[model samples]
Target chain A: MSDVRAEAIELRDAVVLYGAHPALTGASVRIGRGEIVLVEGANGSGKSTLLRACAGLKPLVRGEGRVLGFDLRHERAEVRRRTALLAHRDGLWADLTALENVQVWARLAGAAPDEAAAALGRMGIAGPLASRRVGSMSAGQKRRCALACVVVRRAEVWLLDEPHSALDAQGRDDLDALLVAARAAGATVVVASHDTERVAAFADRRIVLSGGRVA
Target chain B: MTEPLATARTIAAKDLAVERRSRVVANQVLPFAGLVMVMFAFALDDDAIASRVAGGLVWLAALLALLVTVQRSFAVDAADGALEAIRAAGADMRGVFLGKVAALAVQLLVLEAVLVAAAIVLYRVSVRDPLLLVAVLVAATAGLAAVGCIYGGVVAGAGGRETLLPLLLMPVAAPVLIGATRATESAFASGGATPAEGWPWVGLLAAFAAVFLVAGAMSFAALVEE
Candidate 1:
């Protein structure tokens, strides 16, 4: 088996569509280890769709791409197993406490949290609310809990879709530091965002998207 | 960081623990399942119909209970951003699907136990072969939960989860329901485990579970992101 550590996400003429509506044109790029790439575009400009394509979340209904050497069409599971994606909604269980929420993803990500509290602590989520149900959390707090998921899993690649949204200044700084730490650890990072100012310091290159085409 | 079994177990455990703490399953689902069964019993009361429909009654209770629980399964994960995180962390969607199915399976078993116990007490329905009946329960419940897990993903993405869930789930679930009801009827009629007569229906339920599970697990990542 090739070392998973050495792998990178590669996109070549990758196209994605929702029925007849094209979300990504024949776009191509490669993201390598230790690289922090920023995907900047207006809403519905294919920033999210690009991340989805490379992660094998979006099907390459036409054209082709390789993520960590697995063809997006034939080996999606292999591609997905090596990539981590964060999205806009902070998709979480409102009924679960912040700690339980992260623990669930940690388990699903094949990471066991000996102490979920410790993970929460690292994400700057402490005190009584750490155990509070997600439904009661502020958007920033929920995003913090969502960020804790990456810490627990510690995957090689991170595809963050608007990771800085709904955060106050402190939360943005914390996330920036987290992204820096991830890159220092040799993890590949990609951030898709319209808020370029918040993510600028961490990017190795900025790929701009407009009208489903790379600009 | 952990083995897949441990990971799946933890995901299942977290959901189970949270539900236990909140008593959501007991408060919301258990009563509803029991009520559905009792309603059926009352509708079929004081007639030879109760005994005739007992098998269908059990299958019906399981189907309804599983349908309700499956939506809860995805709703919990989707709410916490846990689904996106799991997908991001590159956890096998199959493993995640299995974890969801496993959690729902446990919930279904508990609901089934309550309903079955209630059936015996309230309706005076009795199984001639307790062990064989337990086997039937296990097979049929697995079938229901497996199909439910897949449609749960589809319903999670739809606009109306509560309305859409049963719509998507029932069509896929019909084969298993029919098989389980037929197997139960045969069991009741024969008063024994008759493989020649009962196995085909049981086999159909088993096949439905196997086929959908593989298809569901394989197609899960696609469905969730869409």
Candidate 2:
């Protein structure tokens, strides 16, 4: 968005292992800032694994990476602080009001309360709905709330796994618009999903995974 | 740069708020603590329990309640990846550790108070040195909460964290239990200001707390990552 194309993510032969098994195998990928990339693969094919690695949620077994200029190996915390990862789990506290979930996270990230409320409004969750516990909400609503957290965080990069799973048509469209808007605001977006048809309209690149490597 | 305590305070607020809303401690752990203490009363009769085991019973009940509350704290956070959100925010994992310890400590303190009240009422345990008892209560519960929170994180995602936590925590907690019970016994013997007599045990509790607090804070980021 700033007319600056910088390397936002750089992974060089990065290996990620879970116990004795390898989840990602020497996969190398580069993504520039302000870009929206879709990671596509079947279950256990390392789509989520790669996103987590980039999020600093998972460790690399071998090779190297740098996220937003921080070494993935040594300064993973710095990368994590700058990114938001919406994993398969919605990550919202079921007992907390939807608004509390967003605001607490926003405040934790040092964002203003107004920004949290605005993020909730952007996700179509305000008023009474915002005060309701997340456990009582529908699956789609929970996903939306989680998305609100990601948005409210104001992080530099967003790593989402199957963000469209439970959303309806309208929700899906809202997400597409939100992702595009986020990119326009200069945030890099990497969404892992198999349903490329739904997100391809806004995705700048489509990277496929096979056998843990970027195929 | 954000204030270090800012995120920790936010985390503590969120956790405490959730507990308040859910009443998990009120409806579940408090009752569990009461039930355990009540059963202790039933098992040993009034005289045998009151004179011999009141302090140990209270300590044991608080420990059980601490175990449950600590695990529950992590469970709620881990439920929807809230823990991961905290981590990814890079919002001072040490704060995350301290925040959780603070929440669990508060809940455990409440449980201790309830257990103490129950001990006084049910067991007729006289308070000669309520001061020493109170000191042992606070220091030992702090140690228990800190240790429980750390192990709670360690087993957060494990296959059998539920069972693993107690085994891992209780042994480490034995010193706290022993020191607390011994100190309380001494205070009961000496009466007011008798806590000075058990200062050595109190020191042990404080040392245990410092060890685990530092360890938990340092390692929490790694524990929750997986």
Candidate 3:
């Protein structure tokens, strides 16, 4: 495979701005295919922005980027189709049950309902919990449901921001297992989180961001 | 079904399902519209004047309720970053726009039915032609929903979306209000008007609906993305 195809994510001098302030200032990064990479940063350090840039949710104002061989600036929709980003917000319909939320996302991703239910089951949300409305679920439960959504997406690239926050011990372990399984299956994973000790053992490499640049 | 059409159907169905569970339209918006009609009845105490102005009053109430319904519709998606998630999932943006418009149109149609019933009873107005009235309702609702979705998406996640939506939507929706009111007036045959006079206005409403729907679908991706 060519170098571009060998690397799951490649960024060169990428700059992403929120208004006039630069969230990612001329940052460059590379992660090989099937690698589990952890991105560490302090508050306002642009960790989330880096993950979003890889997911094609944020546009690069000044540099070149490619995820899974699709150019970030020109092929954002293609990148988005092959990647999933789990951010701080659960991204769920509050009025719908957990099962319904995952099913809707599954259908949107062209996955079967059975796959959605199985994802939820893997996240430890089953039976009554799956049937309960997301609005009433505890924060950790909601996070698990959101993870279920990420699971059902079946993307080639996983861009997760703070994937561990709001999860119980079991949920955290489940998430870690999920990440390991994803890497084993050849899905590249980029996670931005402050909880390094938890992810350090399994992460293939670690990169830190300071003031929007790789440090 | 084609992928885009199927995606649109799923989005529309999901929206309707959320609305059903939340009951925001049924419990809140519908009651608010009914109250507006009631207030109009009280303000225009004279039966003849109320009947004559019923068409304008009904459409006016719908316009105000359109603002509320659209706000509620977008709020559901904005509340938990659902729209962002869907967009990042690479679901078709045009499909998303159409689904939202379809859901909003369905809710607005139901609201219009209630408003018309309230108008007939409260204003003591008689319908000259039911078919004309139905055409006016469908076309007018489509225009309202299309415009509402466009402006709603524009302000979906903004800090001042509540006030911003009305400010952005009301001025642009003036044509819809005028067209619907005039067409409805003819439908009721008030002031010596006839159903034939409303057909042209229905055409205008449909045109407005088509233009806004196309524009909204094409621009929805940019509007929702950062």
Best model number under lDDT: 3
**For every candidate, C-alpha RMSD to the true structure in Å:** 3.7, 2.4, 1.7
Q: Candidate 2 has which clashing residue pairs, if any?
A: A91-B80
TM-score of chain A of 1: 0.93
Candidate rank order under TM-score: 3, 2, 1
> Which candidate leads in TM-score?
3
- On the 0 to 100 scale, the lDDT of residue B181 in model 2 is 81
- What is the alpha-carbon interface RMSD for each candidate? 3.0, 1.5, 2.2
Categorize the docking of model 1.
acceptable
Query: Can you give the lDDT of residue A72 in candidate 2?
Result: 83
Q: How many backbone clashes does candidate 1 have?
A: 10
> Which of candidates 2 and 3 reaches a greater lDDT?
3
Candidate 3 local lDDT, B1-226, one digit each (tens): 1277778889899999999999999999999999999998998899989988999999999999999999998899989999889878888988988998999899999999999999999999889989999999999898899899998989997899999999999999999899999999999998778899999999999999999989988898898888
Query: Fraction of true contacts kept, per model?
Result: 0.68, 0.83, 0.77
Candidate 3 per-residue lDDT, tens place, A67-129, comes to 878889999998888889998899999999999999998989889779989999999999998
Q: What TM-score against the true fold does each predicted structure earn? A: 0.84, 0.94, 0.97
Local accuracy of candidate 1 as per-residue lDDT tens digits, B34-118: 8888788778776466766777777788888787788777777776456655665556567667777787888888887787677
Number of clashing residue pairs in every model? 10, 1, 0
* Superposed model 1: Cα runs more than 4 Å off: A1-13, A30-32, A61-64, A68-74, B1-7, B45-48, B79-81, B159-168, B171-225
